[model samples]
Target: MAARTAPAQPAPAQPAPIASAVRRDTADAARWPDVARLPAAQPVRTAIARHLVGRALHRLSLLEPDGAPAGATAGPVLTLHDPQAFYLRIARHGLTGFGESYMAGEWDSNDLPGALTVLAAHADTLVPAPLRRLRPLWAAARPGQDRNTPQGARRNIHRHYDLSNDLFAAFLDPTLTYSSALFTAFPARFDSLAQAQHRKIDRLLDLARVEEGTRLLEIGTGWGELALRAAARGATVTTVTLSAEQADLARNRIRAAGLADRVEVQLRDYREVRGRYDAVVSVEMIEAVGCEYWPDYFTALRRALAPGGRIALQAITMGHQQMLNTASTHTFISKYIFPGGLIPSRRAITEHADAAGLRTTADDGYAEHYAETLRLWRQRFTTNKDAVTALGFDPVFQRMWEFYLAYCEAGFRSRYLDVRQLLLTEGTRR
Candidate 1:
C-alpha cells in the first residue's frame, strides 16, 4: 500500500528565486501540453540564446556538427545538426524556437528531460536582469479568444483534452488518472502508479470529509476516476467537464463500473453549476479557471457547497511574484498550449478561498511525486510513440507531445512546479 496522507503542514514554501518567473497552473507546468506554429529565429535572439546555452544552463552541453563551440563547457551535450538554423530558432523564437527546433530534429539531447531541468532550474537568470525590467515591452498579450469566458473556456479545454482520448490511453496508467499521483516513495515503481493515483483521490476525499450519502460535487471530471472512487465510498457524485470527449468517456466509464446510478457526469462549465453539495472537490481544475476568474471559481465552490460543507482542491502552484509577473504576459504555454489557463500561487489560492468565505484548514504538498509521475508518463509516451502515430498523430505532433512530457518532468523535478492538496471548511468549521 502507498503511504497514508501526512498531517497537514504549513503551505509549500515560495519556490527559490523566480528565475523562471513563469506562471504554472498545474502551477502552469501542470496543464496538459498545447502547441502552435511559431515564427523563425532572429539574429539578436540567437546570440542571446547562444550565451545562455553556453554559459547559463547547468549540466548542459551544446554540440555542433563541426565541433563544440570554442570555450564550451562540459555537461549534457545538446548536439546540433544545423548550427546556424538551430541557434536561430532559439534566437528568433526564444523558448518556442528551442522547442520547435527540437520537434523539427534540429537538435537532440542525450537526456531530454534532464536537459530541460537545467533550463527550468535557472530559467529566469538566463534572461539578463535588465531585460526582465523590459518584460512589458516583449511579453505577448493574452488573446481574447483564449479568455475563460464560458464559450472560450470550452474552446481552450478542447484544444488539449479533446485531442484524442486514445492518445492519452497510450501513456496513462490503467486508471487513466491524468493529474499527479501521491506515491509511497521516490522514483515510484511503474506498476504502482494506479494505486498511488487512488491514494491521491482518497486523500482528497478524506480532506473533504466525503462519506456515505455525502453529496459530492466535482468541478472537473477527469475521465471519471475520482467520481468512481467516491461512488464506491457511497457518496453521490455530480461531476462536470467542459470537454465533450471527456464527458462521453467519463459517462461510459461510470456506467461500466456499475456506479452510474451513484454518479452523474455533466457536460457543463464550473460557473454554471447548481445546488449545494456536502463536499466540493476540484483537482487541478482551478488552473484552467484563469487567474481573472479565480474569484469566480472560488465563489462557485462556496455557492455549490452546502452549509458546513468541506472542500478539497488538488492544485499545481508556483511562487506568488512569479504568478503575478507572468499572469498577463503570454509565454510559450499561453501562446501554444492552455491559452486561457494560469497557475496560482499557494497564497493566491488561500486568499481567494478566504474571500469566498471558506477557511483553510489544511495545506500540504508533494512536488517530487509529480516529477516521478511525469517520468513514468514520459517513459510510457516514449514506449507508445508508434501507437500514438497509429492514432494519426504525425511526426511533429508526436515530437510535440514528447517534448511536453519531458518539459513538465523537468519542471517538477527541479521544484519549479508543485502540486498541493488543500482542505477548506465553511463557517463554524464543523
Candidate 2:
C-alpha cells in the first residue's frame, strides 16, 4: 500500500472579534454573511472556545453557507448555523448589538438553551472581560426605558407577546394561560397539564366566591383562561391584557365557546382599567409591574372592587428581602424577555397591600405546585419542538422559552421562587 499521508493536522481555531467593531447590519445581510469577522481578543476567544467545547464538542462546527470553514474571532463572534444567526456581542455595545442583531438575523443556532448554558456557565469569562466599563452608561440609560414609563412597557409587551398569535397558540394550551403555577388541588387525579390548569381555574373561582351572574374583573388576562372559566361558571367576566395577540385570540375563543354574551376581553393596560366588580383577580401579572407600583396596584384593586368585593392575586415571589445576583437574570429578562417585569418579595406585597387599605384574608404558598406546572410545560414544549418551529419561532426564541421553563422549575423546586395566592378584601369584612 502507498504510504498513507499522515493524518491531516487539525487547523488551529480562529480568534474572536473585538467587541467595539462589530457593525450593525440589515436583517438580510445579518442572516447570510459570506464570512464572519471577529475581534482580536485572544483571551476572550480562548474562554469562548473552552465554554463551547465544554458543552457539546461533537455538535460544534463553524462554517459558511457553502460548508467551507469560516473565519471566527473573539471580541464579538458571530455564528451562522442557518435559519438562525447569533452575534456574541462582548462589549458595552454588545447588549444592544445582540438584541438588534438577532432581530436582524445575524446568526443562527439549533440549540439556544445549550448555547446560553455555555455562556452562562462561563459567565465569569463571558462577562467582565470587557463589558464592565459600560455599567455606568447602562445605568444612566435605564431610566428612559424603565417599565414604569409608558414607552418602555409598551415596547416590551409588543416585542415578545406581539410576535404572533399563531405562534403562541401552537404551544400554549387551548385556554392560553400564560403565567405561573396551576393548582390541581388533588395532584394525583389530573393526569394532563391542561386538565390541571382547568382544575386550578376552578379552585381560584371557588376561592373568589364567584357565583352565577356575579361580575368579575381580571387583570393581565393572558389568553382569558380564568375569565373563560368564570364565564362558564355563569359569572359575567371582563378581562384585560396588554398583548394585542392575546386580546384578539381571547375574543375569538370567547365567541367560539359561545360565551361572548358574558365574556369580554379588552386590549388595555391594567392601570387604565376602571370599574367596580363583585370580584377582582390577577394572575401572574404583578411581576410585570415594578415594586414601585405595588402600592398603586393594590390601590387600583381597591378602587376596582365594590365594597365587600373580594380580590385574588397570584404571583411569583422570591424568598429573600434583598436583591440577589439573579438581579442580572431579571435585567436580561427585562431587556430581552418580559421587559418591565419585577418579582417582589412576600414582605413587599403583603406590606404594600396592607398599606393600600386591603387586608390579606388568606395567603397560600403553592411552591410545589408551580414546580410541577413548569415541569409539565417544559416537557410539553420540548416534545412539541418541531411543531413550535413550524409556527415560525426561531431557535433563539425556542432556547429562551426552554431556559425560561427549566429555570422557573428549578427556582420553585429550590425555593428560590415561590408561588403565592393572596385573597384580599377592600377592608376587614364584617
Candidate 3:
C-alpha cells in the first residue's frame, strides 16, 4: 500500500494560464469525481432497475428488508437509495459506475462485507446475459500516464507513499506493516495484528531460507520491519524503496534498533538493483510492477540471485480469467489508491517465472488472512478519523480510503482475491 498525499502546501498566486493548467492536472488525476448532481432517472429506467435488482438478489439468496426470508433475521443485502439512478449508472458504465454510486451514497448497506461478498461471488453474472457482450464499451481504459515507466513510477509512488508518514502511522500497527498479515488460527481477537504481521514476515524469510551470514535483498521496504528482522537473524539486509518518507523512517528505525550496520536502506528502484544475494524477498511489490513490465521485473530478480539462491514473494492475486478480463481496464482502486498497480493471477506468475528460468518451489494462499488484516485496519482507521483529518486529509479522501480497504476485504472474504507467499529457485538449480 502506498501513501496518499493531499496538497502539500498552498501555492502563491500564479499566472492565469499556468494556474488553469495546474488545476486541470490535479482534477483529472483525482479518483473521486462529482456525482452528487446525477441526472434524474426516467420512469422506464426505474422499472428496469426494480426488475434487475430483484432478480439479482434473488439469485444470490439475499433478501431485501422488503422481501426478507420469512422468520429469518434480515441478513446482508443491497439497500438502494436512488434505485433508478443507481441501476441506470451501472447499466451505462458497468463496474466503474457501480463503485462511484457507492461513493455518491446512491446505495448503502449496514452489512457491507456480507453484501459485497454476495456481489463478488456473483460478479460474472451481475449483468444480464444479452448485455454482457457490450462490456467492452463500458469498461474504462487504462490511462497511459499510469504505466510503470521509471518516471511514471516515481510520480505515482509519490502521489501515495510520499505523503505524510504520520498519516499512515495513525492506522497501522506498531510494526508499520501495510500488507497482508498472517493471523493466528481463526476466531481470534483484533489485538494480535502486530503479532500476525511479524509471523507473516518471518514466514517469508524462512521461505527464502534466510539464515545466519546470509545476504538478503528485499525489494519493497515498508518502513524496514523485514530488514530489521532479517538483521536480527544474523543476515545482512539490503532493502530498497521509492518512498522518501519510508526510507528516512526505516533508516531511523534500523539505527534506533542498533542494527544499522547489518541493514542497508536505499532510495532506489527495483530495476536499478545490481547485487546478487543468497535470499530475495519482495512483499506485495509485484502489483506495482504493472502487467507490461512483469517479465523485466522477474528477470531482474532472477539475475540478482546468486547460485542456488531462492526468492520469496508475497503477492496479491486474482483468478486467471478475472485477471484477463480486467487487464486492459482501469479500476477505481487504481485511480484513487494504488495508481499503476495490478494484482496478477497465480497462473500469470507461474508462466512468467517459468519464462524467466525460475521454477516455483512452493506456493501458499492466505486470502482469509488478508480479509482479517483489512478488517482490523479498517477498524483502526475508522476509529482514528480525527488523527487522519489532523494530517490534512479531507472527508472525501477519508471516504475513498475506507472504501478501498472495505473493497479489498470483501474480495478476500468472497475468495475473489487472494494473497500468496511463493518460493522460487533458479530453474537449473532446482
What do the candidate models score in CA lDDT, each in turn? 0.77, 0.61, 0.78
Compose the digit string of candidate 2's lDDT tens values, residues 39-78. Answer: 2445653455434433332233222223434443212123
Q: Rank the candidates by lDDT, best first.
A: 3, 1, 2
2 or 3, greater by TM-score: 3
The deviation in Å at residue 236 for candidate 3 is 1.1
**What TM-score would candidate 2 get against the native?**
0.68
Q: How do the residues 113-221 of candidate 1 rate in per-residue lDDT, one tens digit apiece? A: 7667777888778778887787677556778788999999999999999999998899999888999998775556433889989989998998888999999999999
RMSD of 1: 7.3
Per-residue lDDT for 133 in model 2? 48
Model 3 off-target regions past 4 Å? 1-31, 36-54, 58-73, 428-430
All-Cα superposition RMSD per candidate: 7.3, 12.5, 9.5
RMSD of 3: 9.5
Provide the TM-score for each candidate, comma-separated: 0.87, 0.68, 0.87
Model 2, residue 285: what's the lDDT? 81
Deviation from native of the Cα of residue 235 in model 3, angstroms = 1.2
What lDDT does candidate 2 reach at residue 241?
80
